[model samples]
Target: MRVVSRLSRVPLPALAVASLVLMTVALTLVFYVAPNDADQGFSQRIFYFHVSIAFTAYACFAAGAWKALRHLWKRDPGADLESYVAVHQGVIFGTLVLLTGSIWAKISWGHWWLWGEDELVLFLVLFLFYCAYFMLRFSVDPGPQRANFSAVYALFGVVLIPVSFLAIRIAKSFVHPEVFTLHGPNFGGWILVTYCVAQAALLLLAYTLYRVELTGKRLDARIRELRFA
Candidate 1:
């Protein structure tokens, strides 16, 4: 709890600066340092960005679900808004995943989208489900009922994440390449380092954005309360 409180107290500007620096370094490593794939060539470079963003999206969803659990199970006063903001960040990153995945498919497979791909289809379904969440959330009035509904919906998303992630394995017809096989990782050396850097950059960027949005929302709520009072 002390650790969590310390992290929460980190200044927004500092986070923004750190995120920018890491993101710049990550992009430089991806484009310049990482070796080109012998097969896919330059196009394979997108894998660094695409996969990292997808994983970051998953992290955001998972964080949202955990916050939702806190709201419901522990009745944490601030958890509901935290969950909402996290899910919002997840959806933003999820959209980027689809865009990046489509670009990758176009370069590798000569198509923008492949409906037969299990991983692609599952991710789309997961994204759409959360899109529906925003609709449901906005349709209801602000109160405990809305909070409960959003929390339950976020919990459901946590269940979907694993299913979407493992779709390539669960479905025999999937053509998506598995990076982590039973033997080991498919790539190594700078490829691994670049990927790790990219992942860290994206996660930091997402967290920074999450904090910014959450702070703005809290300020707005406070302003409204003051006006009403």
Candidate 2:
């Protein structure tokens, strides 16, 4: 059996420093080591971070849902807060995805926003849907009821993800009569390494940000409690 107490604790500052170093190295690899594609050229370099951010956003949402489950199922004390923070991070990354995706679209196509872009449209829908979560959360009084509502809403958001993707796929069959195509570059050795590094760096960055935000929130709550006491 594995010994749970055998694990050593790593400080948040150390994690933050490590994340920063990894990010720097990953960025260096992205700019210096990865080759420009013959098809998309230098603009394709954006794919490293753009796609990575999108994946990270998905992960954040999944994590939020898991925390929400904990809040509802186990009645975990801090699970609601953790779930909110994860959703918050997901929204932040989702916004980045929209911005970077627009840039990529412009670079690939001659336009900034394409109405026929299935992925873009789906992301926009999800972005708006999750943005409403903040409104819903703040509209209610803070208590167990709020926690239950938030948990249920977060679960809905996760379910919406795959459903939205499917809806977009179905819509694409008839939506765009003339399809605009942007192909990803073939992944060679260095390119694959750079992508993996970039992905790891972004995930680490997201986790560090989540930890920082959660810490700030906990501190705020403690201060409020002390003042009231």
Candidate 3:
């Protein structure tokens, strides 16, 4: 709790600057430093961005669910808004996952989308399910009822994360190309370094955006209270 509060106090500018620097470094590593894959060739470069964004989306959704749990179980005063902001960020990143996945698919499989792919279809389902969260959240009047509804929905939606993540492995049908196989990771060397950098960059970017949105919403609430007063 103390740590979280301290983190919340981190300056937005610092986070924004860190995100920008890391993102530039990650891009450089992805394009210039990472060697071309023998199998997928240059097109494999998309994996760095696509997989990192997907993982970041997962992190955001998981964070939202954790905040929602705090709101419901602990009755944390600020958790509701935090959960909403996290989920909103998740949706934004999820959209990127879809777009990048589509591009990867086009390059690898010669299709914009592959319905036969378990991972792709499951991710789409997860994305659409969360998309409904906004509708559910906005339908109720602001108060405890709205907060309760949102919290519960967030909790329910989070269940899909693991399911979607493991769909490729579990499904008997055609699966998306598995980067991490039972034997070991399919690629190594600088590819792993590039992936790690990309993941860090996207997570930092997501956190910066989450904090910015949360701060704006809190300010809006304060302004509303002042007007009412």
Q: Which prediction has more favorable lDDT, 2 or 3?
A: 2
Native-to-model Cα distance after best TM-score fit, residue 138 in candidate 3, in Å: 0.8
CA lDDT of 164 in candidate 2?
89
lDDT of 1 by residue, 129-197 (tens): 999999989999999999999999999999977777676456544554443222223588999999999
lDDT of candidate 1 at residue 225, scale 0 to 100: 98
Better of 1 and 2 by lDDT: 2
lDDT of 1 at 223: 100
Which residue pairs does candidate 3 place in steric collision? none
Candidate 3 lDDT (Cα, whole model)? 0.86
Tell me the TM-score of each prediction against the true structure: 0.90, 0.94, 0.90
Find the candidate with the highest lDDT and give its number: 2
Question: Per-residue CA lDDT of candidate 3, range 1-229, in tens?
Answer: 7876786788999999999999999999999999888777888888898889988988898999999999999999989999999999988988888888888788877899876555566668878988899999888999999999999999998887776657645653444344422122366789899999999999999999999999899999999999999
Model 3 / residue 108 / CA error / Å? 0.4
Q: Candidates' lDDT values, in order?
A: 0.87, 0.88, 0.86
Number of clashing pairs per prediction, in order: 0, 0, 0
Off by over 4 Å in 2: 1-9
Which structure is stronger by TM-score: 2 or 3?
2
Cα lDDT for residue 216, candidate 2 = 98
Q: Pick by TM-score: which candidate is best?
A: 2
